[model samples]
Target: MTKQPESSVARPHPGALALGVLGELLITAGLVLALFVGYSLWWTDLVADARAERAGDRLRRAWAAPAAAPPGQAAPAPTYRPGADGIGFLHVPAMGRDYSVLIRLGTGSEVLDGGVAGVYREPYRAAMPWDASGNFALAAHRDGHGAKFHDLDEVGRGAAVVVETRDHWYVYRVDGTLPRASKFDTGIIAPVPEGSGYPGPGRYITLTTCTPVYSSRFRMAVWGSLVRVDPVDARRTPPPELRTS
Candidate 1:
């Protein structure tokens, strides 16, 4: 028997092709939206919460000891105490490093403002707190709002910066600057210099950070001797001098 001619099938309609493309576009858009939402929840929104929690933890740890008095005081001051025993705070006036939230050296703080937030400074904890004595080298970001020490270079030699603990304030002079093309072997941080050209002295405060505002190609070191240390009560007044009670 002769085979019947096979029937030809019609091609897909143009409307069907258009519908397929539309379906794919909708799926892609949905996926992108989902990714964005996930990132906001995981990174952007939650990051601040984590950081603020850490800052609070650092603050709480300070003053953990029995309240103590500043040096030369006969006894611990009433209602005034030392930084949570061992940890401390560093304050700077002109560089805006003052009034900054303090955490242990090398520890970080929460981002208070905008894009310039959330960087942890590298600190030398062994050095005495500003209120005490010895060298205190603290490093912060050089640029961005997070760049904590961005304007530190602007400080002229003989200018002053203050470091405050729960108990006292230490005044540091901006005596000199150390320029380096490359970072030195700074693993040996101390109450004494490990030979980065800083002289071992009675008391020194060193400030270090990456230079050129936003670049880390070279580190800029600005440091000076601790001119004096005194009870925070002596001169811890804010520029505005509002009642802090």
Candidate 2:
């Protein structure tokens, strides 16, 4: 029998094949980008918050424990020394009623990613909250890793920023704000921060973070003066600034 010529099946065009591959690659890339965003914005916050909570608990436990003193000597005052845990808690009432974050040493990602505000130690040594006449500069993430300063813009002039230590609550009142500053503006953390409307040295608190939301193209700072220091009572009641309705 004469063999009928087998009908040739049409092959996909090269252009169509290339387009299909490109589409698939684009989809994969989009998925990866989305996953990264989710991890950065959500997962990281969860992990950091958990770590911060544990650290905070440990700090509170330590505060509750009675200190040992020599047989005839009184217990010494609480002094801050850099440790793996933390030094204090930051309370920005303008941020929210429950806004609080542990404060640790160093502004590195390793320290900030733990969901805590970091004290600036490079370029300029940030004065501790208890210091008499220097800037207590601090940095925290604005978007992820607890986003401690996400609502920093809301902290207008006269707003309160309190730091809670083992012995005292250092209250600061917002006085100046640089909505946008160069990331390299180290002077903003100086003893008398530049461009913060301060003329000379004094007790100040500077809160800094990435500006314009998720983008880190610039930095934003909120400057404040030491308003008062309230000693911690046995009940540990929050200061008036924090108790406002």
Candidate 3:
């Protein structure tokens, strides 16, 4: 008997095959993007937290065991020496009830990447809290590297930003804030930070971070004035302002 004509097999259209491959590629790309975000947001924080803790511990240890005074010289003040590789802790009540982190010397990534705030040490170098008259400027990451200043916007007038040293706690009260500022506005960190609403030379603390969340195009500044200085107690308890939110 004559064989029946062989049935023709149907093949997937070229367009459909191409679309299937494209779908797979798109899914892969999406997954990679998600992983990167997770790493930036969460993993980096984890790594930075560890580094910060180590640095904080070293600071505490140094304070616990200070260098002996030289002969015929009075003991050095219990303060973190500027121009040295000094690192101190900072506490902001409005940032968080338990907000505390080390403040490093420079605003470079080397220091800020440790999940701590860094003082501007370049062209617009910042003054330490211990300075008698000058702006104590600080910079921190707003969204990554522990996001130390992420909640800076929430800090309102009258909130406290306290810097902790071996012996003293420099307490500053929020006076004003510029929600947005140009990134190149170095004057904001000047001894008499302009646009800060303060009239003239006075003790000030300026907290700056990348603004608009998840972007570094602009900056946000929180300006405060020295309200008081509290001596560290034997128990190392924080000041009243840092006791609550």
Candidate 4:
């Protein structure tokens, strides 16, 4: 018999080849999705946390530096400038004893990338802690970019939310929470937030983050009212509320 041609051997069906290609593509897509999840859950946090630390240090240094006096005047007092490089620090003992993060002025990617909360600048800027009657509103990431408020829901009613400034520690008591609210519900941070039980204008603090753990479809808000303002002491000791809880 003449030598048989190898080309005559049976080959895979076209359908089989197509299926193989499709399988490879699916695998590649799955891998890409996993990598994205990893980046969102881990890598972004590491980078953001580092940046936050640097920002916090800068704020501390600024506070430590004394202001220069005029040629023939008393030395200017050290101050906490709202729109300055660092506005203040937020402390939530209910989240954790060390759960303190810096608060920046603008709620933009640039400000939030530092892994800290940012105050709204349009329609309603955050009222200063010293403001007699206004809302000190803030927003932070719940799932990425440091996730400073990741456990915001853990804060129970009557928990303490403290804001530390250059001159004072503004203590607020958690009154209630809106488990899920539309992101467009600007009233959550209003001077007198509806449904917050404040009834009228008062010193208030509103902490907002994305809801449902990792989704931004809705918002989670924690509302509190300023109970008192304590002058910062030399030791910077935590207030009784924070110290106890």
Candidate 5:
């Protein structure tokens, strides 16, 4: 065989193999993480955009009066007609009525039932919008999957949140943010400021949500005051957003 020329056989290098595997794993993990992060970002953005579109739709539907109501049928009011069960619409330009919401006074977050909503009665109502002398407080969940109030955090101190009824929209502007509040914190519960001697005046709106990103050991409350409550001129409806990128 003429000394077979050292049998030029190639053997796998252990170091290269290990490095290859690690590189593959790292690449896979990187891809997965990239996908997750992208999904999360897009999810939130989509939610915000969809809600904005729905808000505009609500305004349009509110504006459109049934040209003569099929001749015999009477036209219904702009507000979603109260169902036979009696639950009507809760309109907020930021969020549509599709999310069931109720404004209960004495009831607390526990009553919110993981659903999308806002409160108009009691503790929250006493001080919010109605209680010119105190902070009108409200709370809703920032749904991760559905995006109910996900954009709420984006609402700047100057941004306006409108709460509309069958008749009109009640607008409030962000005035302050409560990073965290202790258990049974009266200030967080009441419309007045904490540690203040007397009942604080200044009509305000307080919004409560969970804190520390995912955990709920404490409450994050954002407070604002009613600047105005204007009639929703459905006729002056803004343009529709049919699609989003």
Candidate 6:
């Protein structure tokens, strides 16, 4: 019998070929997802921290240089105005002796994603620490972008939460905490901050963040009452609360 061409090499079954392609695609997708997570959780933080540090330094420099009133006019009282850079710093000794983050005007990503706490401007305008009476509500990411409020859970009742501005330090004593609340619960950031256990209106501070770490399915809040306001002396000394052992 004439030698027939060696039987054509057996081809892979279509099903097998499809499965091989599927496996490669899955592996690629997994690698891409991991890279994204790393970027979101790590790289973003580095960038945000650098930005925050630069902004904070600029703010301190501005504070150090005061404009003198011309022609012997009386110096006007310093007003709290938030410029594009930021407003001030937030210090929670309960978090750490050196734990502080810059604070800006709005809770939008543009502010918080830059590794800073953001004041609420929707539903209700957040009261500045300088405001006579209202909630100085603030929010920050708990798991990424510097995670400024990552240790918020450590702040218990009686803990101090201090807001440092150019002229003063507004100290607040933690009053209560809501570990879990609906993300849509605007009441948690209201002027009086509902569910905060406060009997009525007062100079309060509400710190809000996403719950359950690495997820944003819910929200958490820490409420505090104004304990005191310390004037920033020429030396810019920190308050006793910040002096941790």
TM-score of each: 0.53, 0.94, 0.92, 0.90, 0.50, 0.92
Candidate 3 C-alpha lDDT tens digits along 1-245 = 99899899899999999999999999999999999999998998889889888878877888787567999897876544332345678899787788998887888787787798888876766777878888989998987788899899999888888999888999999999999989998888888988988999888999999989999999989999999998988788988886754
Give one digit per residue, the lDDT tens place, for model 2 in 133-223.
8999999999989998999999999898999998899988999899999998898889999988898888999999999999999999999
The CA lDDT at 76 in model 4 is 66
lDDT of 3: 0.85
Clashes of each: 6, 0, 0, 0, 10, 0
Q: Which stretches of candidate 2 lie over 4 Å from their true place?
A: 1-5, 77-83
The C-alpha RMSD in Å for every predicted model, in order, reads 8.9, 1.7, 2.3, 2.5, 8.7, 2.1
lDDT winner between 1 and 4, please give it: 4
TM-score of 4: 0.90
Compared with the true structure, what per-residue lDDT tens digits does model 1 show for residues 3-63?
Answer: 9999999999999999999999999999998897666434543554455346555554654
- Stretches off by above 4 angstroms in model 1 are 1-86, 97-101, 107-125, 130-133, 185-199, 234-245
Better model by lDDT: candidate 5 vs candidate 6? 6
Checking candidate 1 for backbone clashes, the offending pairs are 62-84, 63-84, 92-98, 106-123, 116-145, 116-146
Query: Mind giving the per-residue lDDT tens digits that candidate 6 earns over 109-148?
Result: 8788989999888999888888899999999999879999
Model 2: weakest 10-residue lDDT segment is 77-86
Highest-scoring model, lDDT? 2
* Model 5 ranges off by over 4 Å: 51-161, 179-203, 208-220, 232-245
lDDT of 4 at 196: 93
lDDT, residue 13, candidate 6: 100
- How far residue 160's Cα lies from its native spot in candidate 5, in Å, is 5.0
Assess candidate 2 and give its TM-score to the true structure. 0.94
- lDDT tens digits by residue: candidate 4, 1-245: 99986776689999999999999999999999999999998999999999889889987887787657888898664444433477789999888877899988877777776698888776776677787789999988988889999999999899999999877899999999999999888888888887798889889999999989889899989999999999988777878876853
Show the lowest summed lDDT stretch of 10 residues, model 5.
79-88
Q: What's the TM for model 3? A: 0.92
Candidate 5 TM-score to native: 0.50
